[model samples]
Target: MFQPRQMTKLLIAASKDHIEEVIGELYKRRLFHIEDYVRNEQEEWSGYSIGTSLTQADQISSELVKIRSIINNLEINEEQLPKADYTKQSELSKKIASDLPDIAARIEAILLKRSGLEAEQKDLEQKIETLNPFLAFQHPLEILSGYETISFLAGYGKGTPVLPSESELFTSPVRRGEAFNIVAVRSGQLAECERILLDAQFQKVVIPQEKGLASAAVERYQQQITGLQSEIKAIDQEFETIKKQQQLFFVSSEELLTAEIEQAAAPLRFATTEHAFVIEGFVPTNEAVSLVTSLQKATGDKIEIQELEILDLNEEPPVEFQNSRYAQPTEALIDLYVRPKYTEIDPSLFMAILYPLMFGFILGDVAYGTILLVVSLAARGFVKGSEMGTKLIQILRNCSVSAILFGIAYSEFLGTSLPWHPIWLSRHINMGGSASHGVEYVSHVPELLILSIWVGLFHITLARILGAKNASVMEHGEHRSKLMFAHIGWILVMWGIIIAIWSYFPLLLMPDLTGLPLIAGISSSALFGGILILIGIVFIARDNVLELMELPTIISNVLSYTRLVAVGLSSVAIALVTNYIAITMIIDPALKNFTAISIILLIAGIIVFLLGHTLNTALGLLGGGLHPLRLHYVEFFTKFYRGGGKIYNPFGMIRKYTEAEK
Candidate 1:
């Protein structure tokens, strides 16, 4: 798995010799063939069309058995089955396809009718289920299917009065409409007419408003009426069920049936006469060789297979992109992140080494690192939001080792004295002072930053080298020499320029105008760098004299690494702030006397500890790593890197869902 490898080649051939035997065997095995007439990626297989024979006839036949079970459950007979002829099936499919809207309308009408019946039936059942046998009644309320309008006397009222809707929206005194007649009916007269309402889109209808009660008593009356209103709704539901059964007779089950051999030959019916056999599919790399060989032997030399080699297909112009080598992490790290663009090199390798080192150097607290390591380990398995959480935890876990190492170097152990203190610090401290003087401070953090810059330079250089390699391979004709010279010349210029600037420019910022003259001694180095840059620009721009101006522009772009030092200093400054706050709390006796002060100190200390580390860790990840990646992608890759090459995807069995890759 560690070894890098190139993609394999595909072999293709064409033959027309054993067409009949091939078709027969394919039918017997229930294996289908796919044809894409257009030699491009967007073409779809026409096997889904009606009248096209399914090559997986056996598979479809198996599916038919399931359909038969459903039909049997519904008690549909053979005579009820539509004709299963291949021609008839095709014709029926075409007819269904042609007038789908009309069919939908009919289906909807039937469903509406069924829904009314269902609602009515459900209302009746609920009323029955809610019956209380012990309730007294003057006379039994009889349930009937037909309507009756009868009123002898109003119940529980000394007098009765009626009010009509006379508002502007419904009825205005100025513009009166016809008065509607009304009667109270206890019997179910409307149930028969509701069948017509099924085709109607009346899911909800408003009851006409009547008024004769005081506003304060209306709520009480409504609670009583709501209970009765619920009963009628149940009755509507039952009526709908009966209407649904009648609709099913119109839809044929034949298309849903399994016809094994016929389904397998489905695709063959769509193939053109010019193409004897067509096969389009994916196979896993491991199984590809064996499957291709077996198929060749079975079909004999009369059949031919053609494969498309996508990755090596030289059909497009090349563009530059980041090389994968610099970012590659160990195999142990791959399970944590999304797949990188290039599989040859994992990007995590540089991150895996540098991240922990930076964290440990800045934090340098044994207790903090240990706690982070433990928490990261625990959370890695349980964090569930984004996958990035898992990766972040893994990164923290890796960095914990660096923290331990740096903690040892700094001689810090849970804010206590180390097992050994530096000899130089021993001379400068009184016996009662805190352990800051205990460990010889590595005091070499500035040197470490320098080392980091060197590492960045190396990675960037390597990226340029790969870019040249890409250019050499892609532009192999006469232009190859020019490309090679440009890449080499640019690298030399960048190296010299960086060295000169690093050694001399920092002195310019020093509080000494006298030392600024020392920069002239390195003047020759700058001159060399500028000349090389100019030459590279001229060559890359195809000997155009105007392109020499691009040298200064590109050089400025390459020198954005000053942000590295700026960010590293920020990390150190954050740590100092935390230390100052923590020490100030412990040393001030007046503040220590108050409980609130101690509480504030505790809260602030914890906050700074957690917040500072998180911020530094993020800065380290982005500024330390991503900026270097940007250098590789922009500066180095600009020399030459082709990005449009198609990925090598082999043909294999594809899992639809839930199954893991083989």
Candidate 2:
């Protein structure tokens, strides 16, 4: 489509009672794009105000939050869930009212219980570790502590302390890592012994609060830990079961509640009085009547609807692309750069056609194209949710098709000629490739390069024409005419340069155009081209003297297209070299001998061939993808495009897991 869908403004004013039904129809049908209302205080001393959210919006929101919390606690990711079961909205609402609270309470209790049990298990594990170290002492726990007359210290340190001869001291034989010690001293002399232990880098460890041998206590604690582990495992199993059972319900509920909340809050964007409400929005002209009829029917024809032919000078309507299915993928790039304004022409169709041709021209190869097609097909499903990524993949798919078609034309399968002669012209004739194909065709390198320049000329000329049209629409007054003329001047200058090159050096420049009718009519083509160039410069200078500086761009932009030839030739050369090293030098010699050494070389050569081609394929995808986009962005779109349009965000939700009953 050349233009976006035509839109009409609809203003609806109705009694407050009909607002609920009206909102429901608008949301469910997904037609309206609401233009939010902002109240002005000085509007003739107005008493109107912005409407609040609809009744029970708060209730629905609270319940939605609880459902989300439950889903999160259960770690129920929608991606990992099985296919959702379709159910009526009414059924889902009833479940929310009756089923959610009970499920929420039970799940909460289980989580709380699981947390308490896990805490107890952690505490028991610590107790076991503490008691295990004391086993080396071979002492009853009660004897190590709770002494008033005698003070004791139990810890692990770098070395044993040097205590008084009168004090009782003990050290473990296992002293490789750290020494474990127990030392008792009289209460009056405890400080001196503590200092001596501290000096040895002592780290005090607490003795467990228990009685009996350390071994028995450790055994009892381990038993308690085992019990706690069993309870935790059961809780986990229960959670997994709940996740499986309620995954569909959770996903469906979340989507439904989200839609419901949006509808309920739709009133917030409306202008309201004590008894009436006003709604304003845009709808496609084709669908406008249907929307009005549906709303009136839903409200029993109680609402008053007015269609106004009003234009706001300051604000433009939101832009929704009206590209065909084939051209739609180009929207991603347009959005990435900047969306086209409502008044300007959409370039999706232009980009859709040119981008693939440019890409195929640079990376034409049947094998590479087939690989790209296969990869894009396999990845389509995974990127379905990502709109931009999906569009890019689709673009890749389209470009690959172009590449295959061009590869056939160039007589290249991967890096060599096909079994038959090319359907179109071949690129490799001058590179000794004609001998293998046995066609003896002359190389078209110069012709292709000339063709590249011609492509640039046509593309830039089209851009100038589009730019002039856009200037007429977007520009105004004296400046608009001047700007339009500047675009025209560039076009003239580019054509002049091309004609001069053809007249002076026919073979070195473009394919011989001397026999053409236009060239034949001109007595002195060089002089005619110079005159045209001078006139263009004068027109460009009329806008601003600085504009003349850009005159040289006509030359550079045309030469930029020469990359189409240079880059593609480089790719072909690489492929040729890879085949030569792999098949001709390595594999062919190995097969002639048929020995162990030969077989090994053959395998290595095959590896070399695959790796080489793999590298080339990656290079093709990158070069093919980026170069075409660069040519479009840098060389083509810059001439006409000045995108800064707002994206169209329609007021509705896309349902995925549930269906609404009629």
Candidate 3:
């Protein structure tokens, strides 16, 4: 419950011929986390290859690429497609070997034709646009291009340019919106003509290759474009139909092909020799026996599975946490910080208990709790079958339950007190005040602060106990005993200090001991507390003298829990102010008489009340959720947890698009 699952290293050796069988068995069982064999060039024994070469690996990889490309080109949305039918391995292989080639060839041909038509369409559109400017000129394209001696310039200018009479320049000026299309041809001294055109702000335009007027050329290009567009539309429709027919097949084939590629590449992780192969991996200790039996059976006793007796200090085993269903959701929170090392304890169970408890204490409101519970329940249904969503909903549900329990104790519904009596003294209740005005149980600052400190003390104490247990697991001999004693000393010192504070401080919750006899008797607790502190210091000094500096830190850590009370008080205050304004200024006055002004004020007050409460609830959730998590992560987890372990990743498939037959 407190620790991660134990792991054992398994060294597997088999003949080259049985390597495939061994790999298949291990993958099917999904029990082993393969450790890639690293070859040390300097060591002769490490230089040998341990696994047989995967000759089909490259072929499988190529097929996988092609399959992915086909799927991508089809733009298949797996969510919109129907689930694929389950097919045997042999059937799938044969279908892919025979049918895929033909399908791919046909699709490729269509795509190629579509690409050519698109290019042609684009070219025709460009040609038409280029020829549109010359439409005003009534001249053949051949005439415009054939003249070598007479240089002709056709382009748009800001206004018509003055033609040079001596050069026999023909000017065709046509207005086009804000600009004029000018076509001029001169016989000689073209440089002077060009300068005049440039002075008129003329920008040159290129003529198309068609040997006709610009209008005729545009008409011809448009007809071709229309034809090409029709062809492209037909090709797109064909693609759509093909996509609908083959999306499911492509999705299933991709999964199968990917799996095959992974299997073929498995040999790359093994160390191979001329006739034998060696594979090293970690498997759960509980399942090691069954996995070995299965592998032996699958390989016909050709493979040898040996559990290594010694673990290398440099190599850390992969961690797999085994937690109850209720505690599992807390793993997500734990992972957000760090994954526990294989040697460290799993804190999910502890977090499961503490996280919600603190959250409820911080957000103690019946109405908000009810709302959260409803929302969480609805979310659970909506996010069914999604692992992350389910975990989040579970956490919310637990927090909501805690909130409700605390709300009842606090006698709070939303930010106001309900008519029902509280099981315990409500935070709003003035414990020592008169009852004539009806005892108001507002969460007094001092009381809440004291409660928060005590909670913090208890939480930190538990953390230290767990940390001591974890230390005992990792240490040995005299060192383990010394660490354990130090942890005990710290625990004693914390309790002693708490006891001494209760006696010495004139706290609201504690009884007064002012007389000489009472003072003398209670002073012993302070003395006992001092003695415990000295004992703790003595024990921890052996580990490191610097650790003594942490004594003040314990006080600070306990004080940090005051955030719970501060946040809860803020929420209550906001709610109280909201209720006061709504009731005293608007709702109460309006209830006296239903005048127009009063009714208007009443409606406005209702709006203000709802908005204010909504904002307060949101803030409460944020503060309530985050501060509790901070307390656990920063103060609690740091005490015991040394995370950063690798997760176990086994070779197996959890098919969603397709299933295998039993």
Top model by lDDT, which number? 2
Indicate which candidate wins on TM-score: 2
lDDT of each: 0.43, 0.83, 0.79
Candidate 2, superposed: residue stretches over 4 Å from native: 41-45, 128-138, 149-207, 210-219, 310-315, 422-425, 429-444, 503-524, 544-554
Model 3 residue runs over 4 Å out of place are 41-44, 50-53, 83-85, 124-233, 312-315, 381-386, 425-441, 477-479, 485-503, 510-522, 576-614, 657-662
Please, what are the lDDT tens digits per residue for candidate 3 over residues 134-214? 777687877766676776666777655686775543345555533535444555767888898889878878866678787
Best-to-worst order by lDDT is: 2, 3, 1
Worst 10 residues of 1 by lDDT: 166-175
Worst 10-residue lDDT window, candidate 3: 430-439
Candidate 1's residue-wise lDDT over 415-450, tens digit each? 333686522211111222433423333444454445
- Backbone Cα, N, C clashes tallied per candidate: 57, 0, 17
Candidate 3 at 360: error in angstroms?
1.3
Writing each residue's lDDT as its tens digit, candidate 2 over 79-149 gives 77776567689999999899999988989999999999989988988888888778887768898778788
Comparing 1 with 3 on TM-score, the higher-scoring candidate is: 3
